[model samples]
Target: MILDRQLLLSNAQALTTGTVFSTNTIDLASARDIGIGDNLELFIRVIAPLTGGTSVQFAYVTSANADLSSPSIIVQTPPVPAASLVAGSEWLRVQVPALSDTTSRQRYIGVQYTINGTFTVGTVTAGLTLDREGLAVYPSGLNTAGF
Candidate 1:
C-alpha cells in the first residue's frame, strides 16, 4: 500500500486558451517495488474559470506510447466527472485499490476537464500528486517475483 505522504498539486494551469486547461503527463512509474495488493492514492487540485457547459474527464494509459511531452494519452470511454472547483481548498482525493493478482497490468494516469458549452479563455490547471511507496506487484505467481 502507499506509505508516503499525500500527494500535492497546486498552481496547475493550462498553456493554451480554451474552456479546459490541462497539463502535461506526470509519471506514476516510480522505482519502488510495486506488487499486487498495493494501494494507490492521488491528490489533485484545479484552478480555472468554467464558463462552457462541458464536462471534465480524467484518464490514464500504461502502454509504451504514452506521450508525456505533448497533449496526448487522454482516455475517451466512460468519461469521468468534473467536480465544481473551489478556491483555496480545491484539493480532491481519489483512492484506488491495487488490482488483483489475477488481473493486474501496467497502466498510465491522466486527467482532462471539459465544459458542456463553448467558452474562450476558460483555461484551468490541475495539480496532481501520486504516492506508490512500499508498493509491490502481485500475481505472476513466482514468475514476476524476482525471488
Candidate 2:
C-alpha cells in the first residue's frame, strides 16, 4: 500500500534574479527514525526562463539542528545553457533511496541554488515523498505534525 506521508521540502518561492546564491531548508522530521528500505522522491518544478548558468542542488541530512554542514545529495542537474530556459520548458524529478543501516535521529531536506544570470522571471518549488507502510494524520494549523 502507498503511504500518504507527503511533505513539502520547498514552497513555491520566487528565485532571486542576479548572480546570488541562496539556500532553503525544510525540516522534515526532528526524529523520523527512518528505517532501511524506505524511499524518498524529490519533485522539482521551475517556471521556465530559468536563466542560463543557474545551478541548483538537492540534498537531505540528519542532524540535531538544521545546520547542513554535511548532506547526502539526491541530484544536481546540469546548469541550464545560457538563455536556454525558454518559457514552459524546465522541470526535473528524482527518486532517492533513503535507506540507512542505522536509524536516524533527525531528517532535514533542502535545496541550494545560485542564480548565475538574469532569470527573466520564475519560481522554484520542491516536494518530497516518503514511502512507508502507514498513513499520517495531522492536527489543524499545527506545522509540527511532521515531527
Candidate 3:
C-alpha cells in the first residue's frame, strides 16, 4: 500500500515513555468536506516489539494549537497488550469520527500515543486514508471477518 506523506502520522517512529506527536499535523482552518461514503481513517502498525510497557493506545485528537498542547480526543484504539506489539502487527484500522459540524471542530488534526507504563522499546507507523480496503470486521469478534 502506498502511504501519503501528507496524511501520514508516525513513520516507523520508535516511541518510549510519554506522548509522541505525529511528524505532520493536518491544518483545517477552512471549511472542507471529506466526501460522501468516505471517512478519514488511521492505519497504525508495529515495526518493533515493545517491552517494559503495560499497554499502549492510539488516539485521534484535535486541538486549537498546532503543537497540540491541549488535545480533544475524537476516538482511539483499544489498548493492546505489550506482548502483542510485534513487527508487522497492525495496531489499529479504524475510521475517523463522523463529524458534521466543522465549526465545532478544532483547527488542527493529529494523532497521539499514550503509553500506560514505561516502555524501553516500541515502534509504529500511522497514516490516514479515505479509501477503505474491503469488507472486514464483525460486530463482536465472532471470528475475525466471520459473518
Question: Candidate 1: which stretches are off by over 4 Å?
Answer: 1-11, 15-22, 26-40, 60-64, 68-83, 86-92, 100-104, 122-147
TM-score of each: 0.43, 0.52, 0.76
Worst 10 residues of 3 by lDDT: 30-39
- The sequence of per-residue lDDT tens digits that candidate 1 reaches over residues 27-89 is 446554433343445444445543334444443322332343233332333432334533322
By TM-score, the better pick of 1 and 3 is 3
lDDT string, candidate 3, 73-114, tens digits: 877888877888888787568877665676538888887888
Q: Which stretches in model 3 have alpha-carbon errors above 4 Å?
A: 30-37, 102-104, 133-147
Which tens-of-lDDT digit does each residue in 95-142 have in candidate 2? 654445444534555555545655546665565556422356876885
Clashes of each: 21, 0, 0
